[model samples]
Target: MIPSAMSATPQSRIEIDPAVVTAAGDFVVPEPLGFGRCLAPVVFLADYQDGQWGRGRLLPYGPLGLDPAAKVLHYAQVVFEGLKAYHVGGSRPMLFRPEMNWRRMNRSAARMMMPALPRDLFMDGLLAVTACSEPYIPRASGRSLYLRPALFATQPTLDPAPSTTFTFMVVASPSEALASGPLRVVVERTGARAVAGGTGDVKVSGNYGAALHATAVAAQSGFDQPLWLDAISHRYIEELSVMNFFAVVDGALHTPELNGTILPGVTRDSILALARLEGLRVHERLMDVDELLQMIRSGRCTEAFACGTAIIVGSIGLIGEHDGRLCPLPEPEGPHAGRLRERLLGIQEGREPDPFAWTHTVAPLDTSAPDRNG
Candidate 1:
């Protein structure tokens, strides 16, 4: 069951466009909702200026009037987060651990030298957009309402310092889990995703751009994603292009520790907590790519997979080096990975008990009147 929202004063001003509501009412999710390919018809928006944030609103989904000289355009002052809302079998629509994303977003904002959003404002914006978009949330297992909250520098200036103004928006998409089955991964020996003491732990805009080339190159070679190595010593495995790396070695789960370079993913943390509750031994350590490959060859490492908000849990079928050499995992179906994914899906879709209290229920919105504001 979905948990109730916290008793915070709603600061979001709602203004639903008739067209947006009609569009959502008339919309039917395509058979294949691939990742973020389908966007909801409405969005949540707010602004920060004069050293404070303004009131938030639920408005029609559309393009923004970003100036050509906007600070985000030139200086790349941006941070964002990805979370999901689930509504399956006509059950209560709910969000999964959104507070984590809120906390993580503020952490990124702090590192980017941006102002923090008030808790009420964040909650209001998230709930308002999600409530309005509830009609579009997919009701199938592995499908959800993917929510994206982003902050961008809006002030136009040539100064190198942080901008005085910023824009915060929450957009949603009705979609299925990104990627499917096992993934073919390519090891990236060159270039680093993040340095030792950089903005690697946060979901800033620049981090994805830095790893695009590697991912693009990997795709050309028939790989789903790139396996990023550590910045200083390229031997240790850090993470994937979008997800955290995990390997099942000797009946235990081994993942790279959060060493200030890997994004602290909500999905990754959930897996760690759930795995421990199941009495499974989980090790968070620096995994050497070379040693892991040898373990795979020796049959010690039976399975490996990647986990994130979008991908959830994707098994790694094969891992290859830059020289085009590929090594296949014996059990790509991932006996442990499959079990963990089931446990996760159960909790997410309301089929299993949620002991950790991660799911948050969203109240159904009354969109009967287009002019109604809340």
Candidate 2:
């Protein structure tokens, strides 16, 4: 049986606008698309006030009205989630590990003192939006409908307390694969994305915003991404700006363990599971930057990659100083990274049997029909 959260209810309601179908038909994707290049014209929205969730409504995508003193605008009390809907080899659109994203969003909200979204409401919002936007989902291998669900405090106050009102929205973009080739990462020795005993493990907006400067500096210096170290010592490797990092050293896959300072990524967990099942040794421990550099210098660390719901598995070709002092990997496209990427994408796209039961299929919405009144 489908979980109750995914089941339709008489009391639950969603309003679909008539413009969605025409927008989907008119949406034009380029011949060779890249990630996050285009957005769908429809969005799903719902409001929470007085401790009750309002009926969700599907409408044409547009800007939102916000008070100048909104808590989210001033205090940065916002959280979000990222997952993908796959259309390859599937009769309907399927989500890859959506429950994990939902759970993570709640974790982030709780950390920020925001109200957690009920499981049913969370699932309903994603399903309703993806169903309405199904026709616009890109139909290509390594491409998908990127789902972004965000929650923000809307109370017009400057108080540090949690807001009495909140807005939850789910928007989508038809995107191609994020990383075209191997990445070149620069070790971030100075800045820290998250602090200890802070919102490091959560998917809050501030976390990404804090990492922007370092990322920008890395980009200007010609590195593809910044590999952040820990906050205190800046010695222990934590993660990338938006993804988790991993390295294959001495035939073993080594990734930074989930310390209080690291985000527990769904793709990172999935990769660990698939690696172990495929008989590759996997280790989750404190990977020190100095130690990794030594390994790279000694030629023990052959390849590295970054994993996330968006990037999937992006191979790391080199790591080092910004002045082109590159620590080149023995194999940029290592066998393990390639094999694992294929296996994970296969499960997500329904090209292979879902042994882990991770994918969830959502039915398409009929835009021509009237709203089902609650």
Candidate 3:
């Protein structure tokens, strides 16, 4: 429901209707909340046509009437981003590295041959939605308001070209972290998440749907996710199905280098920066899966974790290969991953001093809501 306090200031290009805000107030988030399950009652929608983005507005969240032949429907010409808003023990919620998400989203849009979203629209839309949906952001330390910004081709055509018209929308879900504990991942040798000179580096919609088959297979085989290898060699570790991978090898953080196939994740970058700042050795190199398994077996690799917007940092409990081989980490929740998660969460949740200034505060629509607890 639209909160009355969500009215856009005169300086804002985006519009927030009073009626929409009023309707939003009626929504009540249900209990037993899980990640990405409970959505805010409203969303921000902007359209691009005639080679220009239109004035956007907040609307009640609902289904869209897309054409059957829309470019996004047929050709999957769409890209999206995921970020979060935290209730950082204040009346207002804080956004963690939103600018990074905005920049990455534009990168994805560029890769998909879509027009870049203006920074004003992106920031304003995120601020507007997060401000309006502030009450729904869970107060729990590990929970947050998950924000998703997506752009898709809306042009109704069968031609195999980028659509001239596009739709940009921002929707939010209030829930806990995607993964709560250590995960068991399988090594996927058959399929690749992204290929060289492909859309793997961007957050394209097809990139996720393309990996669903491997995820399904992994799940059936009792794995949480699939660790995709390099598309060419199928030996070097590229990334997990959705998150970037890391391992604590010999008291050092080792992750796969950005080899044109890995999504340069904001959390992954933050972890690296934090690790290096703490005087821990960090390496970004071509990590071979076989070698990593051997290292785990030999106790050279003490821990492994996956990082992303949704999962934050998930410890890798076990790594399974295709031929019934399982390599278990000596300590799944080792100090390295635990400390990183703690520090990252502390910064994001406003518990610790933000030395890096990664958090952005968003004023709440209604100040009456109680301050978030530590």
Candidate 4:
């Protein structure tokens, strides 16, 4: 069931479970590559302690031996990141804007009073896991190997201070795009997903946990996701549960500015860059939900979409309120969203030229290569 453990080299700090290649080779790709459902056969793991990071390992994908009183489980000292590895374009897998993810992960760690991840170690984990899972990576146009790198407090202590030890792991999942065509969203007026001066700007574990209740409520109300608002006045539109919000008012793209509450999305940034490069006017300012709805009613806003690592570029067909009032986007699938999604996906999947130099093609580590030790 599980591959064996591994030993690490002092310099590279990368260990390999000899059976990892076999496990990955024997694994089967899922039929309907659901989002993050099919787990790869192997995973990359590392630890942090003694004021420094330890060796990393390529281990079997299995349950972890987490302590019951772990700070992550109690005090919520945890952070995570999501990025993708495309199998198209070349023999080696391609990573889109992974360095941005690394930087953001460290920012989140800093906010949570945790340590920053070294760039080399982070890339090692990503490349190693992606290389090991190459066989199972879906080859379809919109599908990819969804890489989730998570860091958590591992020290077994119930004290109210930070944990002395931490664990980092990178797991791969062969999956399809999170959303397709258009989406139906609900305005979450009562619940605030994130607030200013909080963990809203970072991808910490507690942020998602706090949004679950409202997500459930929105799902029950027949919506795909909830559109979160500012925590204070509840009038300014912050972001969606997992994605950044955007609108096209009078032929110009408008998204809520980064107000220390919204997660700065990688895909959102890429889309903005693409839009600007294509000569589309963009406005990154405080977006009011009521004003956006009014624009939709007055036909001033003709387009709406949300972007994130999961939902690359998802069109918002309609947005509804808690009282069952609905405001449909002027166009269900607008041309702007379609055009932006095409360009973004093109660069991501290697179908088009990467003008921004945003992709990194990962060369698989040779299993047959001799170990560092002679």
Candidate 5:
């Protein structure tokens, strides 16, 4: 049974969908699943209007109706978060550093002029849906129930004003580790993901959409991902399209400093913490592309990688352009990256101790009802 405490409190005025419980038992799990290959059967939803939030509900996954002129459609006022639930060491599903996502989501919402989902509601929405979908949580290490919580404008207007109404929803997917091998990244010089004093620091929808073109171009050119440079001068290395970039130089871990143009990824933060705990020298500072390329050429840069919720820790094998000018890291599978990935994944998968108290475990759903035939 879903835990009663997982439900929203009366003060929050949240409601539960009667159909969600029925749908949970009837939902089917597929075989041979991969990362984000399939979505869970249920979703948690809430709405905001007139300066107040309405009751929330857990509903079966489906499309949402929206006006074509909605601010989110017209002005691109939307933000989202990505986290995961682990089903390791036990049947229960556990979230890793979910509050960080909650806090980051609110920051994005604020940047987009959208009202932030209250912390209680945010946690409740996530826990409620995870509880409902507990049976579907993947049970293997390096596999998880990927949680995505997003908020968007709903008002139908073109006046460039903040939407009077907004919708927030949390959805889940059974996923495996995102990347399989060392990645090849191209140094992007033609496009920029975010500009200074812009929404680059936020997890807004526009940021990802803007990167798709460059990412597509890079992918077609035989590169796994694009290493974006600063939008102002295109000199300093910013990040990968979806993940933060890091390089191991002279045995020291160096990543781009948060310059208000990089998404402060949860996994990125966790890796930094774990690295420090493991006694590695970690530095966050401006990294110039030319200097890094030179270091790689001189064998001074031993390794490079990208980190995010999706691609936990992916080492970079090669870095350069499509014109045959490339520099490869001395050690594609560097000792530091391997150690960090193993340690972090170990904590996430329950194979090691979670000294940071990052995981929140949810009880399994009751399976007493007869399985429904679809």
Candidate 6:
């Protein structure tokens, strides 16, 4: 849902609604927490207009009141980022490489012709939400408080141009893995998810909207996600829905190189570094989908997996096609994906050493929640 901003609110001084504070106090963590199903009771918001950002606010989460003809509704002038706050093995919450997200979000905004948020503005929203929602953040293994910060055009107009006004929001969800088990992915040969020189590489809102149809088609084909190829030739692999693709080929890790059409996923970057650090060779090139499937069939490709902010790392049990054909990985449970996933999660959850200084600790504004271990 879109977030709304009130211009009349004070400037430079963040406003925390009394109701929001009380709501955060009374909010109860949901049972059987599904990813993004139940949102934290409060949301952090800020408005950008007249070449400046307004003071942020933390208010009760609810539906937005849009002008119905907003630019985001018609032209989709929006970008968003997905990251998590972890409260495991420590009372203070940790954010894994959030500066990367901040920078990537601004890149998407620039590509979308939107204004970039000031560093303080972006971090303030994130720190505010995480600090306020400390009591509700899930503390179990593989569970985290997923934070989503989004910016969308609020200026209502029919012209095909960037909106002068925008709304920025940060929302949180205490959640579990999006897909807990090994995934079944299908190759989408017919429909193209993104075109070269388009908004494919960025976190533009329209990129995901364009993938909805193929995702549904993949679901109907008995798969969890669609493996999209390059939009130009539809031969080379690109990425999966909101995730990056990886395969272990001939005792080495292989993934598609960034070609301006594939998303530079944070998890994918982490995996590459971790794999290299663990003495595994990694290759990023223009990998062909057909060749990958053939490698799987020939037992040369041992395993395949996808990584993203939500899934972390999900093994692909089998790769399928529109036709009734399947190419199962010889080692679907991974030998590589599993190890890489463990290492990545270890770094994320603070269970292992973070030599890279990727983990960022956010001091709680109020430690009303019980001990994280309890």
The list of candidate 3 runs beyond 4 A from truth reads 1-11, 365-374
Candidate 4 Cα RMSD (Å): 4.9
RMSD of each predicted structure:
2.0, 2.4, 5.3, 4.9, 4.3, 6.2
Q: What are the lDDT figures for the candidates, one per model? A: 0.86, 0.84, 0.86, 0.87, 0.82, 0.85
- Global fold similarity of model 2 (TM-score): 0.94
Stronger candidate by lDDT (3 vs 5): 3
Candidate 5 local lDDT, 1-374, one digit each (tens): 12112323222344555577778778777877777878888888889998998767777888888888888899888999999887776546677888899999999998888897898788877787787787777787778888899999999989988898999999889888788548989988878998999989999999999899988999898998899999889999999878998899998999999999999988889999988887889999999999999999998899998888887888888897867798888898767777888888877776678868777666443323332110
lDDT of prediction 3:
0.86
Predicted model with the maximum lDDT: 4
Instruction: Point out the higher-scoring one by lDDT: 2 or 4.
Output: 4
- For candidate 1, the 10 contiguous residues with the lowest summed lDDT are 3-12
Clashing pairs in 5: 1-366
Better-scoring candidate (TM-score), 2 or 4: 4
Number of the top TM-score candidate? 4
Per-residue alpha-carbon lDDT of candidate 4 for residues 191-263, written as tens digits (9 for 90 to 100)? 8988779999999999999999998988899999999989999899988888998999989999999989999
TM-score of 6: 0.93
Span of ten consecutive residues with least summed lDDT in model 3: 1-10
Query: Tens-digit lDDT track for model 1 on 1-374?
Result: 34454333243255554565676677677766699988887888889999888777777788999988889998899999999888874356778888899999999999999888777677777787777777777877889899999999999887888999999999988888998769999899988899888999999999999899999999999999999999888999999978999999999999999999999999999999999999999999999999999999999999999999898898999999879899999889888888999899788877788879888777766566534564
Itemize residue pairs with steric clashes in candidate 2: none
Candidate 2 lDDT over 40-134, as tens digits, reads 77788889999988877777888899999999998999999999999887788888888899889999989988888888778777887788778
Rank the models by TM-score, top first: 4, 1, 2, 3, 6, 5
lDDT of 6 by residue, 210-316 (tens): 89999998998799999999877889999998899999998999999998988899999999998888899999999999888888888899899999989999998
Q: Compute each candidate's TM-score over C-alphas.
A: 0.95, 0.94, 0.94, 0.96, 0.92, 0.93
